[model samples]
Target chain A: MGAGHAHTLHHVGDSPVHRLPAHVKIVAAFLMVIAVVATPREAFWVFGAHLALLVGIWVTARIPVAAIAARSLIEAPFVALAVLLPFFATGPRTEFLGLSLSVDGLLAGWNILVKGTLGVLISVTLGMTTPVRDLLAGLARLRVPGMVTTIATLMVRYLEVIAAEARRMRLARVARGHDPRFLWQIGPTVRGVGTLFLRSYERGERVHLAMLARGYTGSMPLLGVPTTGRRTWAVALAPAAAAVLFATAGYA
Target chain B: MTPSLEVEGLAFAYPDGHQALFGVDLRIEQGERVALLGPNGAGKTTLVLHLNGVHRAGAGTVRVGGLEVAKPHLQEIRRRVGVVFQDPDDQLFMPTVGDDVAFGPANFGVTEPELSLRVKQALGAVGMGEHADRSPMHLSGGQRRRVALATVLACDPEILVLDEPSSNLDPVARRELAEVLLGLDRTMLMVTHDLPYALQLCPRSVVIDEGVVVADGPTRDLLADPAFLAAHRLELPFGFSV
Candidate 1:
């Protein structure tokens, strides 16, 4: 799980999407989501147009459609909630395939589907383009609490180690003839989770001591010599502005 | 010059009923490289943890660079003593190699430009300057260890407390690590089971067994004493007795 998740989320590339400052991408994505959410449910054409814009961005960013689709499907279960809404909502009923469907339900379904799809697309795009470090940097730049970033940085770094430890424990259990298939076996699985938490907590303490030994005063030092020049800021803001404008029009 | 580390009657026990260390005493002079030899559960790690007050001195004093180990002076003591854990995974807890190295310096409040320079210098020392942007998870075990060293090196601590510096490393990588350690000029206290590595890298050897310091002398003499090693649950690898 660690290897696979780490591999999928982080890819090094020199594309424009990759080069843009993380803060810009985050703000742009948030705005795009807000735009999609605020758009009227009756505006199906606008949703179609927004989806096309996202697709264009993905194509230009050189991200594989299959990867995006696969990620999209991971969220499909939540999307199913919206898929079912059309059957229960109240409004003028319309006959479709000899079954009555409420107009309000149909609109509600469209609203959820469009907003959720756009939100997921924006997030997936950001994840595909930005490395986790830059994402944290972007958050830091945007005034995220230092403690939060520190925790996140530590979490991402040790996530693989923790996952590997979990895998080893699972393998050990399997070797001991413990198959976690039945409900009764779930108690042991939950205990395994508790053990993982304890191990992680202990590891965190040790790591903290190690950090203190290395002269860690409090704040994490910034690297890469950030140059907040007008050009860099301009480069970051251009796409964001364009995204906001497009989303605003869709809302209007 | 004052000793880089001076521990007298050091002892520690977990909050639970289990005791991990008994009375221990040791002294390592400045610029001296010493290897702490022990088996698993030999309290080598517990001793290392005391150098920077990580484990806290249960009943003794731990003085690093003339400062006593106490709550008020912890930050200053920590600044002087850098520790690298056995697991690189624990030490390098940042996304990119550069960021991980920069973490220590950043925590110490080094200015941005200086922090960048420190990061470059540390990574360069480990021959990993090119990997600064790369994620640590993608690196090999040896590379991860090197990066781990760089992370601590970035802080520029006067004393380095390394736990198992050569474990799980291939021969070439171990040789590379040895070369790197030899090149470093700081006072080093390395904990390891690798006898040859201890002999090659450190002039002094300190043996801890069952949480007590059993032997402390020149590496050659300690390794030469077969009975002393046997008494401490340590033995020369195979037929290669020292």
Candidate 2:
């Protein structure tokens, strides 16, 4: 529930990015990612342009540089896999800074880093501006499976409750003089996780019944009377469209 | 007009061989606000669950609005019976208040325009219209409870079944909830340990102890009877004899 927690990633703002329709943003993000992935690794200039375009968009959206850096750092571990490729990969050997590296490995690493960074940036930007509900609404609008959207919606809604339950359970255990610190004490933590899972499962059943009582048959309805104006779509697509054209010019 | 609800010889037992309800029988008239008072493990919830076909009756029948609560009428029964669970967290499962409110109507196939109107009107009824876009978790306990009620109200049910509706509310919120309940025109079956809330919101009362109806009468008269309330583990607040 703390503001800096992963679940609380959304930043309240009045930027155009914040006002963009979720469905449009979702589609645009997907298209941008596909375009990035399809771009060859040798297109170094295109990658540079892509990064520049993203940076420009981020700046125009008024997202804080510190926030972006923190999120990128959080995502750094996944990108670290790509970083390792340059050293471990087998190809024509090259020496740099007293270390051996491979030509193919360098290209592989560059490809992953650029593609992964772009993908993560798109997702992080989406998460930071749009509330979780809007994301689900957007997914629903984009014809993602209803069940998938419903499950994601339910999961996000109950995540806090589940986390709170875990916290309460931990406190209760600690009050009973259970100190789970060392490897040997991991038993209690495992048992706690198991208990949490069971509690969550039971809660799901109860929630289903509650839904039934409220006349829930299956599909969840769209949130808010969607006032999807042309301006909203136009604004959302501008950055993605610009990025695509910029990346395309690199193809020429 | 037919009664809002009728249960005859309704019995249930868990798979572990523990019988919860032992041939319980009850009748609720149309537009009647009745409180179902019982101690813990007295099958109060088990009985209410039967009204909407959540819990199947083991040995008898549950009828809502003249339709038998069977598989064929399950959806219809649910549409007409709005159940507000004790835990608002469990009730409001959707991410936003608006989605949660619209859930019931959406399932029942209310058109888009009608659905929006119902969601708005329902939230308005609970005085939570401004919070439609807000996440349910972000709301206070009272607000969540109001949204939970709105979720049910959106379905436009004829019989509102609320379990411990005022359990966790502060005094002001509890009073706000009481006023909201009072304003609703539908027949309500409220299950609660709070005798005062029952007395305030319901005209009639039914006592369930050990899976059976032990007493049924006017709320005031029943609460006034010391022996009757004590028999079912109910007590008026200190110095507030009924």
Candidate 3:
């Protein structure tokens, strides 16, 4: 059940968290993120508890902490924005390291940094535990429009195919002595991307045709797990339930 | 019983005024394995599309299992006629192998028990029962082809049309696919450029050129005529014989 193509971040294992149905995990993750966002930013301990919750899941799911840390670097650009907030944000100023910084700006920066990190962490944990197909299924079960899940499913399926085509096109250009290292040689690269887009569009057409040939009249059939039971939901949502408790305590 | 596939006076032209097929007439009885030999733009795919209603017939008629290939019978026709496209990647678009195989049946409104049974039976037919949990992306070209065939088979189609099935396969994969195809006792129309594959798998061969069926004869007799093959722009591999 773990074959989600090679591009997914799913850590294939037999952990209880992994065993839980995808929709339940999706709900749990959603609730966890909502709790994180709802908690007051000043409740720094609640944020710590959120991180601890994620760390526990990672440990149980057998995902490497180093890998999650590395993946979380995708938010580094946001960190840059957060770093600048203290300098330009208009609020009461405090002196730190001989430089005047806004106290509210510091708090705002922490809000973005912490919330964004926790959000991304929650997503990574979900991604690592649930296969891509299951994630889409979870979304489907949550009544998130079928059209969105269908698009997501196809994206997961064809991501590598299109990437491989791009690689092949690059190789063909390189074989023809097109040097991409120079600034002036960007024309063909841009055109190649354009060509790749067209090719992908045409591929989409062919895939639709193939789907139709198999009697796909209009909507895609619900191909996900038929039912995710109440027991599974209660079992899976425990972490989010813990986060909710932490959030209420934080409010208190 | 009616012929498995019957296309009479079939014709098609693209929206750009490009004439792809012109009044093509063909019929294949039940259980016949016919190889469609054609050049790059000889309307083989266009004809196949007409078989399953992907392309509405521009001129004439197409019937599958005695049912007209029109709006009324499209759903049923698609169930009866399965086209395994040349590219397996284009065919198997689901996240997992089982899901891809199940896609067609589920679309056909086949519910559980029957749906899962078809998936298992189809995968078993292609000798890929073990890899149902794997991603089609991770499979070898041949394995992917087999799974693609399974996706079609899971629909319980009466006729299978394959487009360039042997393309991009190593010799071993090619032969293995041939074995699988040989074991399936259903009507098949294989569109291919491989003369040797035609000679090996199909007893009868149909040659289409310039939007028409130019020749329809025994595979051995057709491949034996070098001049005829050369005239159709089909060249047998050197030193290969029927």
Candidate 4:
């Protein structure tokens, strides 16, 4: 949302993928994930096709391969879960390298690793191409629940302000000779959080009053009516449709 | 022609038994920019809130364009009275400057063509015509303040009530904002502790303290009264003259 500054996840570019409407991208990303999820775990080559499709998008969008790899580390916890499955999952056993491994467990592990990684990669690519503000706008255009979208929009707007306030309060606390690191010394830190909450709540009431002053009765009004047309959807959803075809064709 | 605003015996008390305004009365003509000067807790904000129906009239009546600010006319009253809040953060809550400015008019059912025109005209008035798509948070504090003003301006209200418009502004930003406020033609009721700002922007001034209008006169005469200022904790900056 920066005045000409692109967000970290969103690379500034005029690529065909980037120029596509945000709602179209949102729908496309969602369908890609759905196709990944719906694909059979045994279709290993189809999973490979999915990865190639995403990588093609990455190249077209001009996002660095390393950046995608780095950002995808957010799925490391799931990776850990996948790795542990073969050891902990109770199923039919098989011998491999002098260790009895559960065959079903190994298959389950591969399932999670491949499907989860593909899902996360598609999401990461989506994040890399679209600004967070536009993402929320797309959600609204897709007829997401009003309350959910409203709360999300506000939260995105205020997150930085609240973070900066927290930083200043922390500095002031330090200046006043308070160390919050010690377990026994967390009282002041906790109190600071409470103070921040109260301040934020009071600010919300003031903002609500400000909104009321400007003729806000109950619902929020739409600022931009998304004009994403049929052609844009057809073009944007092509890759997702291809992925779906790959999943359905049993390409493995 | 009717006065732009009329408030008579407007009284309000909090649920905790703290009375903020007790029988406050004021009148503003169609094009007068009046400074509502007061000490802290003097109910300046309370009175301004009543103008827009943010706070209901507990006792007396408030009318804008001869329309009472009662339940029946709340919407019309709000549409006619645009309040610029103290913190720009509170006012500019939308994603973009254009969106924020358009919020007020769109709520009153102003359709697209006119809405965009209003947004453009308002932003142009504030010298922010090119910032229609920019996020308010990305702009400098002064720019954000101007955008906040544009948000109210898009509504084209009969009266503009500003709360501490110059509170957090630097010297340059304050002067720039003062220039903008001085150029506007609407009736303005500005609540501020900035004495010099009151002198620069408003010709008429009213001092309200302890829930009452203590003094009402020309801005220069009121600021020059040392005893009157001291009684209300209103202090002009050092070496500053009227």
For model 2, how big is the CA root-mean-square deviation? Answer: 2.8
Quote the lDDT for A167 in model 4. Answer: 93
Compute each candidate's TM-score over C-alphas.
0.86, 0.90, 0.94, 0.94
lDDT leaderboard ranking: 3, 4, 2, 1
In candidate 3, position A170 carries an lDDT of: 96
Q: What is the Cα-based lDDT of residue B77 in candidate 2?
A: 90
Q: For residues B1-242, could you state the per-residue lDDT of candidate 3 as single tens digits? A: 79999989998999999999999999999999999998888888889889998889889999899999899878999999999998898899998899999999999889887888999999999999999888777899999999999999999998999999999999999999999999999999999999899988999999999999999999999988989988989988989976
Off by over 4 Å in 1: A1-5, A10-12, A52-56, A59-67, A173-197, A217-219, A229-252, B9-23, B38-42, B58-60, B209-214
Candidate 2, residue B122: how far the Cα is off, in Å:
2.2
Poorly placed runs, candidate 4 (over 4 Å)? A2-6
Candidate 4: interface RMSD equals 1.2
Q: CA lDDT of A178 in candidate 3?
A: 90
Question: Worst ten-residue run, lDDT, model 4 chain B?
Answer: B49-58
lDDT of 3: 0.90
Clashes of each: 1, 0, 0, 0
Q: lDDT (CA) for every model shown?
A: 0.81, 0.85, 0.90, 0.87
lDDT of 4 by residue, B18-135 (tens): 8999898899999999999999999998888889887887799999989999888788889999999999999988777888899899998898788899999999999999999877
Candidate 2: list runs displaced more than 4 Å. A1-7, A224-252, B15-17
Candidate 1 per-residue lDDT over residues A92-205, each given as its tens digit = 999889988888888888787778888888888888888777788888888788899888878877888899899998888889888877797788778889999999999998
Chain B TM-score for candidate 4: 0.98
